[model samples]
Target: MVSSISLSIDSDLDKVSLLARAVRALCEDLLGPDDQDAVELSLVEAINNVIKHGYHGERGKDVQVAVGLQADQVVIEVIDHAPPMPAQVLDKAPEDTFAFDEADLADIPEGGMGLALIRMNMDEVEYHSGDSENRLRMVKRIAPRSQ
Candidate 1:
């Protein structure tokens, strides 16, 4: 089975929650509640990164989020027109899961965990930069709903 929905929003942080809610709703019947939360969180983090880093928090910029259910997977693509991320950032995969050194509170960096969070939640994460735009694609496997 296959189904998809796309939503467009200005690069404003406030709008992200609304879009996330819509996405969570879309996944409700197809995915379990916990998976639904993962989808929402991943999408939120991806969109937030685009708005803050890609658009430099500038409002009115174009951002599109598309969620699709194909077979036993959920595919999400976050598209934007801002500059693409640096190659180093895009190439680095989560080799070792994120661990916190609770030993020292000051040791942890402030922010910069969006990509990690997205990667941890989604099964597959990829980014493509085109001449006119950049796209970040994320996919998560889901159990097929019983007929």
Candidate 2:
């Protein structure tokens, strides 16, 4: 069986936490306790990117959160009305550009590292943009193998 829920909210950093909490609850219930932290952290990072880069610091734009459970996997998607993330952004090697220090965090640039964290925590990550919408989908595998 598959279960899903979606919500649209203003594009704001503060709102990302709410999205994370909602997604985490769905994942925990559907996917079980294993990797719960990883799922929550990934969702938080993805929602942060949707608010920051996707919306380009704009206010009152819609950020959509969708969660789904199918068989042994949990999928979460964050959709925004803004243009898709640059291919280079997603393609870049996390080791090279995502390494951040305290100084870097203090002077946070317009972009860096969030997607890297999302990639690291999720089992699969995909991005799609067309028809005036951008979608970032992440999947986590959840199932126990019998010995």
Which candidate gets the maximum TM-score versus the true structure? 1
State TM-scores per candidate: 0.90, 0.84
lDDT of 2 by residue, 47-75 (tens): 77777777788889998888888878888
lDDT by residue for model 1 (1-147), tens? 898888999999999999999888887777898788888999999999999999999999999988897778889999999988988776655543345575788866565578888888888898999897998999989876678
Instruction: Give the Cα lDDT of each candidate.
Output: 0.86, 0.80
Which 10 consecutive residues of model 1 have the lowest summed lDDT? 91-100
In angstroms, the error of model 2 at 69 is 1.1
Badly placed stretches (over 4 Å) of model 1 are: 95-100, 144-147
Task: Report each candidate's C-alpha RMSD, comma-separated, in the order given.
Answer: 1.9, 2.8
Model 1 quality (TM-score): 0.90
Model 2, runs deviating above 4 Å: 32-34, 98-110, 145-147
